[model samples]
Target chain A: MPIVTVASPKGGAGKSTASIILATELAHAGAEVTILDCDPNRSISIWADRGTLPPRINVRSDVGESEIVKTLKQQDADGRVVIVDLEGVASRLVSRAISQADLVLTPMRATTLDATIGVRALALIEEEEEALGRAIRHAVVFTMTRAIKSKQHTAIEKSLRGQGVDIITPPLMERAAFSALFEFGGDLRTMPVQGKMEPAAENASAFAQAVYNRLVGKGL
Target chain B: MSDKPTFSIDLDSLKTRRKDTTPESQGRVDAAGEQHGFVNREPNRKRGRQPSPRVGQVHAKVMPNVADEIADEAKRRGVQQGVIIEEAWVLYKNR
Candidate 1:
């Protein structure tokens, strides 16, 4: 199985949102998926508690760093896709997750601070590659983007590209539906299937699909 | 695979030793022209077999000096040379 780790050092960068969207989308696509929630906030755990996650999307919360590695190894040995929702800070466990991930997705807001914080995460990834003797395919996807006044977004995009970071297409717009997702404890894909309609529901689904395509298409 | 000898052959010392071994060594024109293929000293026999069709036995062009390139970049980046070297090796291995 290929492990996809969603991580970022800056808080409120929508790491959990991206993780949940990708997990729910993949599970809906008939893949055996499991999420290892390493965030102490347990945002994903709360979402799972509210019965938002589908039965196919199995989530294991409060897992330590070593346990996450063992579980990922087991899943890889069994040929299952494992998506890890890492905490929004740099920690040993988060480092281990990035080290083990076949692909690392670092979601960033369009602010300069958020984009700057991604540099630290990228440097950490480089450090992990040095220690582990392997390269993990990573990309930065812009989240909560504003349609107009996108100068900050463009600047961040240019900076990341100059640093040789892959920026995935179809930026996730800042929609009330995304923040509203937490209240219902469900992702975009789950909301539509569960008969709850929102204006940005389809947009969220499309964004999630783009993430899936990039990850799965590269065989990561 | 047979174990390759692990002798540390310093080129600078070898050049100094060559100067002591030969009267005309102080004016050494070129190291490559003199040393390369000098061990198999039959010039006429070697010339005839230079382009021999022995695919596996034929030596390919040597790879560039990757370590030196990495060290230069590491110096410019103000980090350890090993960091650049290791990152390149990891990228190559992963690819």
Candidate 2:
């Protein structure tokens, strides 16, 4: 019944992508999962509307700040693991969710553009720590990092480590299958795949498992 | 064994209330001049009468510093802010 939030202030950080992948994987593993699609764009909402979700997985769309806390508590009370996909900005709602979170997942792409905005998102978590007088558990998942690490990616990783932020390993490599989830309107396990689908699926699963491990403190 | 929580915003009453009240009014004064057939019924008081000592939610405002203090204490005690606030309110009343 952990509440994990996928958040980043920067758009194109793969926040929605990572959220959907992790949620679907957890559901495939038989966990009852509910996704709060808090993004204004309603990415998960649109995806959910496109097809039937796997049993035990539900999507709650258009969750505003007023409704977030009660809705989250209500969802958790029903024995479902709750995942909040936050809007790509630092705001009161983001802080509120972070304060109540069991774990906060911040997605960061391997680029200078994402690095700066990504740091701000992580800082929002720190702000919640100040507000609550406790360390809010959180980590950064480097999204779209190429296997051949660019100089920018290495630099970004080193910078984050200096700030003592934990990064989920096996950085989510860029994959067509991930986007295909949105394009095809289904979970990773159910989507029809082409040549790149196998490795893409593996990456998505490993990324999800890594996130789950971090959430439970089973892995770094 | 459980499903999502539904709303307390009942939409069923719209239809039933219309049905229950419409015939009562129409039965009293029919177009055919039928005026004394049915006993006069009091239009139903608000159905789904809210339980007394009513529990409801409210949005409130306080100083940001005060809110932060409450949140910090809530975390320190591993309690919800609502619970802490409720106890503090009672203690304040006695004080």
Candidate 3:
């Protein structure tokens, strides 16, 4: 079982969206996924409540700093994957969750403010690695991107790469389906058609596969 | 959609590794987080004694001696006067 934590200190950086997309996609691919909604916003819980959660996906909400580690340990088991969605603040809940994560995915939109704040999560991971004496695998995934990359997006990607940061390819585009998950409650397949559903599913599927590849020790 | 190849997960390939959840390791993680301004953000629970849940009112006037005894017993037992009243009611029902 792998615990993938979606964390970012910057608000509106798509941490919740990324968590749902990954969890649902993984569940669709025949993996039992448990999502711990640690965000006070209750984004995942609301989504799970709105509609029938896709089969093989279970959502637990209101996981605070104290219960995070314990809840993660309880939910983790063979043949299951746990996804933790953290609040968009630098809090002990985020740190404690990251400490138990097999992979920490920091979702950042293509903006300077987002990158500046999201990098704090990466720095914390580095420090945690040194303290825990084990390498904590982490990567950055750009969310709410456009079909055409902006100059700022290119610059930030370049800067991060220069710093030897692992950036997940096929960044999640600003798709209507991605946002519609909150309203529809189910995955893209089960939700009503929003915009062009094909590309959205493809993007989410590939992004999840990239993550799965990493989890299985395959790079990129 | 059926024409496209869907992603599939090989369950056997996924492995779970042991993580340190001991207090010492957690303390170190917390320390590192604090250095980066990720301190405890949990909402503070209210301090001091919680409000008593005995909201019901009893208008019965007891004899002076019985009232004094009840007050002294409540104080000695460190419980609200309501507890004594409830026990007395139960005793009446049993009788």
List lDDT for all candidates, in order: 0.64, 0.69, 0.92
Please, what is the TM-score per model? 0.63, 0.67, 0.89
- By lDDT rank, best first, the candidates go 3, 2, 1
Q: Which lDDT tens digits does candidate 3 get at residues B1-95?
A: 44233788989877788999999999999999999999998989999877669577688799999999999999999998999999999999999
> For every candidate structure, what is the RMSD over all alpha carbons to the true structure, in angstroms?
28.2, 25.8, 4.2
Q: Is candidate 1 or candidate 2 better by TM-score?
A: 2
Candidate 2 yields a Cα-based lDDT of 0.69
lDDT per residue for candidate 1 within A134-178, as digits (tens), equals 676788878888767488788879878897898876677777666
Model 2 residue A142 CA deviation in Å: 1.1
lDDT of 2 at B14: 15
Position A180, candidate 2: lDDT? 76
Q: 2 or 3: which has the higher DockQ?
A: 3
Q: What is the C-alpha lDDT profile of model 3 across A156-187, one tens digit per residue?
A: 99999999999999899999999999998989
Q: By lDDT, who's the top model here? A: 3
lDDT of 3 at A84: 94
Q: DockQ of every model listed?
A: 0.01, 0.01, 0.58
Candidate 1's displacement at residue B47, Å, is: 79
Better of 1 and 3 by lDDT: 3
* Model 1 lDDT, residue A216, Cα: 52
Looking at candidate 2 chain B, the ten consecutive residues that score lowest on lDDT are B11-20
